[model samples]
Target: MVFVVFIVAAIITFAAATKLSTYADALSRLSGLGSLLIGTFLLAVATALPEVTTTVTAVFLDNPDMAVGNILGSNHFNLLILAVFDIIYRKRKMLAHIYKQQRYTALFGVFMTLVIALAIFMRLDIPILTIGIDALIIVALYLLSLWIIQRTPVPEQEKNHSSQEEEYSLKHALMGFIIMAIIIFISGTALTLSGDQIALITGLGSSFVGSFLIAGSTSLPEVVTVLTAMRLNNENLAAASIYGSNLFNMLLLVVCDLIYRGPILQSISLSHAVTAIFLLINSSLVCYAMFARKNRRFYTWPSLVMILFYILTMVWLYYSS
Candidate 1:
């Protein structure tokens, strides 16, 4: 029964997520929002809706480990999606043409992940009027990231998407995006509950299950969105989505802290720091790949290395847990 619920949730989430990318693209074009900004802010938020829902649900369920793990694990998974992008993008080096705007976004992810690692290790007892200092810092940084991404100059081609031919109107696109988001919210909630139950049934730590299974499930939207963006030949959007999703994933810690009964960061297992480390490394790899401008036969060396590291990290986390 638990397995059935999980599979069903995954299917529904994927179906909704496929629609999510399409409407998000339409919204970008109709609104005249550059793919960089839309991919980072709007599309990133839309694709990350599942993570937001799942994290909040985990917190309300009193599963801090699951909440934290899901976000960090999803962060890693988002970057892993890039590796897939590189393989499929056979024309040119995938990361070579990624917009310069994403440089700041990637760096911001590193900064936020570092903050999370610090919070986990420090576990500060100090709270400002009931809110942990770390939570406040994370929220502040996330807002700053948003500002930076918004202000960055978008290339002319990206800015002129509004002039391009699109299939949906602004109103219809908004409506479709909202409907898909609602479906994702419902499916993600179901995934969270079943994931929690599965953790218990398997006698595995929430950190393990949340980091691997739950994280992968919640990240379905991102994977679909990234692939869809690539198919459209908007590699910048695909790249930005991954970077922006990582930033959004970190921001979700604030949401988790707010809904959780206690200091969410302090309550999470230190094992999650391992996951954070992987996220930081993968995010940094993105920066390196973008600047290195190297291309390979199938995929770049960084892509392969990052994927290997992720698999190894998952293996280690599984046995360690």
Candidate 2:
């Protein structure tokens, strides 16, 4: 029964995520928002719905470690999705096309890494106030991205776009958004329950189940979307979505902590340390690939390197834990 629930939830999660991405793209076009702003804010928030719902549910169930582990684990898995996207774009070398805009994605990736590192390494007491601060940071960064986009000059081709092409029907998009949100909420809850049952049956910890299984399962949506986007020649959207999702995950942690009330740091596990190390290494590689313009543009080698590193890290974590 538990295994069945896990499978069902995974299916729902994938469907919901696809719908959410479609709606997000439409809404962005309607709102006249640049990819950077829409990707970082609206799309980011939508993709992270599962994380938010699952973590909140775990916290309410008094499984704080599971909640934190899910976020950390999801972040680690999200980085792996970048490699997955690269693999899908093998022939075209997706990164080659975005040599100019890669810097923005790299910067966002670095910022997300710093935020996660601070959460993991800093020994400061996790107060509710910290959540408010984190929320402010997220909002500020999103607004800043929008400002930058607005101030930047648009290319001549973009300036001549028709009004009909830019505007999306809001009623249809909103309906789709709501439907996706319901699916994500329901599926995430089912997955959380399944995780708890598996932990109980196997005598494994909830954090262990949430981190390795649940986190990886739930992140499939982001992985599939990125790979699909890459295949469709939407390299910019793929990169934006990946980075956007990371920022959303990090910010959601703050919200989860605040809502759960008091000292979240106390519940954080050593698994977070391993996850953080992997994130730092993966993010550094991304930044390097983006900035190292003189090097060969092909991401085949870098993608392989990331996959190997992720696998090794997982192996080490499993044995060590």
Which candidate leads the pack in TM-score? 1
Q: Could you tell me the lDDT of residue 294 within candidate 2?
A: 39
Model 2 TM-score on a 0 to 1 scale? 0.84
Task: Give lDDT per model, in order.
Answer: 0.83, 0.67
lDDT of 2: 0.67
Q: Which stretches of candidate 2 lie over 4 Å from their true place?
A: 99-102, 126-170
Q: Write the per-residue lDDT of candidate 2 for residues 88-167, one digit (tens) a residue.
A: 75666665555354466567656656655665666545344555343455556655654654465433332233254534
Error of 2 at 91 (Å): 2.4
Worst 10 residues of 1 by lDDT: 290-299
TM-score, prediction 1: 0.94
Which residue pairs collide in model 2, if any?
none
Backbone atom clashes (below 3 Å) for every candidate: 0, 0
Candidate 1 deviant stretches above 4 angstroms? 294-299
